[model samples]
Target: MIVGLTGGIGSGKTTVLNFFKAFQNISVYIADEEAKNLMNSSPLLKSQLINAFGKELFVDNTLQRAYLSNLVFKDPKKLQILNEIVHPQVAKHFSEFVALNAHKAYILYENAILFETQNNQFCDCILTVSAPLEDRISRIIHRDQTTRRAVLDRMQHQFPEEKKRLQSNYLIQNTSLPALKEEVYRIHNILTL
Candidate 1:
């Protein structure tokens, strides 16, 4: 089963992913991390990004992540263009991952933009994690060392939390670690069974 896991920035999706990792029956794939790896490693992807953004996308042959983040967060078109450049490669890679993990009872594909990218179509079921807006803002500001304005800019590009909640098969309202873990375990049992 391909289980799509997604949430907005700073919603603790990574923490929930960790809890799911404790279950031996589940295999996990994190799309955003893989996208970064692809951007850094693939020469073809590198050229495409440079064409869309600029030569300064890389410095000393390494992706200038901070540069790209600042650029895309401020412009919706740039963000979409970046996604268009990266998502196809990630999707292809994810298909290979799914094939290798076909024996697993559940394949948890974690992506922040699953719904935004319409990747949910590939999922057997979708799980959306959510938190209060202020909590989310605070978490991202701390984790990314970014300002509230920047976080809000990125949030605007994502599908609305309310809409995601309505569409998802399961919802995790993340408020505390203990509660989050309990929910993850409960959902894991349900999926595996």
Candidate 2:
């Protein structure tokens, strides 16, 4: 089973992936992290990013993430364009990851935009993690060292939690760690059985 794991920024999707990893019965493929790696490693992606964001955005074959983020967050159109440039590649790599892990009882393909990009088509089921909006904003502000407005700006480009909640086959409320772990384990048993 391939479970599409997703949540908004600061919603702790990665943390939830860790909890799922405890089962030792699944493999994880984090799309955003893979996209970053592709941005640095893939010549085609590097050229496209340079064309879209400017050549100065990369240094020593690595993306200057902060600089690129500033431009994209300021303009919704720019963010959409960047996503357009990267998502297809990420989706392609995600498919390969699934194929390699085909023997696993379950695999977790974690991406923040699973539903938005219609990547859910690749999933056997979808799990959406969520928390209160203020909590999400605060978490992102602390983790990204950005202002509330900036976090809100990025959130603006994402699908709303309520809508994701409706779409998910399973939902993790994510108010606390124990509950989150318990839910993950429960789902693991369900999937494995």
Candidate 3:
């Protein structure tokens, strides 16, 4: 089964993914991380980005991530356009990943915007991780060294936690590591069965 693992910024999806990784039968695909890799390594993607955004977005054959992040997070249209450019390639890559991992009992495809991108339709089930808004803001501020305002701005682009939770097959409230590990194990057992 392909399980879509998703959450908003700073909601601890990565932590949950790590817990899932401990299971021998589970294979993981991190969409956002793979998108970053594709953006840098794929010539076709590089040309598309430069054509749409500008050549300056890529400096010395590397994407100017800070510049791109600042631009996209500040503008919804730009963010949408960027997603348009990257998501299809990621989806194709993800399909290949699933085929390669077909021997596994479960494949966890993790993305922050799984619902937003309509990728949930491709999933057998979705697990949405959530945390209190204040906790999420604090986590992003510390991890990314960005201000609360900046984190909030990024969060604005995602569907509300409540909406995601309502749509998901499973929900994990991530407040503490011990509790989270317990929850992950519980869910893992259910998914594997």
Candidate 4:
């Protein structure tokens, strides 16, 4: 089985991922990390990004992330274009990763934009991690050392919790670590059964 684990930024999805990581026979594909690497390494992605955002978007043949981020996040159209260029490559890489782990009992695909990209369609089930907005913002601030407004800006781009919750097969409230672990183990038991 394949499960898609997702939540908005700062929703503690990574914490849930860590719990899932503890389980044996499970392979985890972290789409964001993979995409970041691809963006920096793939010649095709490099050419496309430069075409979309200009050569200044790269420095020393590496992604000028700060420049590109300010450009994309400031314009919804630019962000969409960027996603269009990168998500397909990321999806292709994910397919390969999935094939490599097909022998496993199950695999987990963790992505912040699972719903947005419709990647959840590829999963047997979807798990959405959720937390109160204030708590999420605080967590992002503490973890990323990003300003509240910047965190909120990124969060606003993701699907709302209500919508994601409605689509999810499992909803894990991430307000507390102990409770979160219990919830994860419960879900693991259910899946294994």
lDDT of 2 by residue, 19-111 (tens): 887767689888889999999899999999999989899988889999998998788789889989999998889878888988898889898
Model 2 regions lying over 4 Å from their true place: none
Q: lDDT: which candidate is best?
A: 3
- Per-residue accuracy of model 1 over 1-193 as CA lDDT, tens digit each: 9999999998989999999988887799999889999999999999999999999999999999999998998888898899889999999999999999999998999999998999999999999999999999999999988899989988998999989999899999899999999999899889978
- The residue-level lDDT of candidate 2 at 73 comes to 79
Which residue pairs of candidate 3 clash?
A: none
Query: In order, what lDDT does every prediction score?
Result: 0.93, 0.89, 0.93, 0.91
Cα lDDT for residue 135, model 2?
89
Give the TM-score comparing model 3 with the true structure, all chains together: 0.97
Q: State residue 106's C-alpha deviation in candidate 4, in Å.
A: 1.0
Compare candidates 2 and 3 on lDDT and give the better one. Answer: 3
Residues 45-142, candidate 4: write the lDDT tens digits: 99999999999988999888778877887789999999999999998999999999998878889999899999989999999999999998998899
TM-score of each: 0.97, 0.96, 0.97, 0.95
- Report backbone clashes per prediction: 0, 0, 0, 0
On TM-score, the stronger of 2 and 3 is: 3
Residue-level lDDT tens digits of model 3 in 109-189: 999999999999999999999998898999999999999889989999999999999999999999899999999999999
Candidate 3: C-alpha lDDT: 0.93
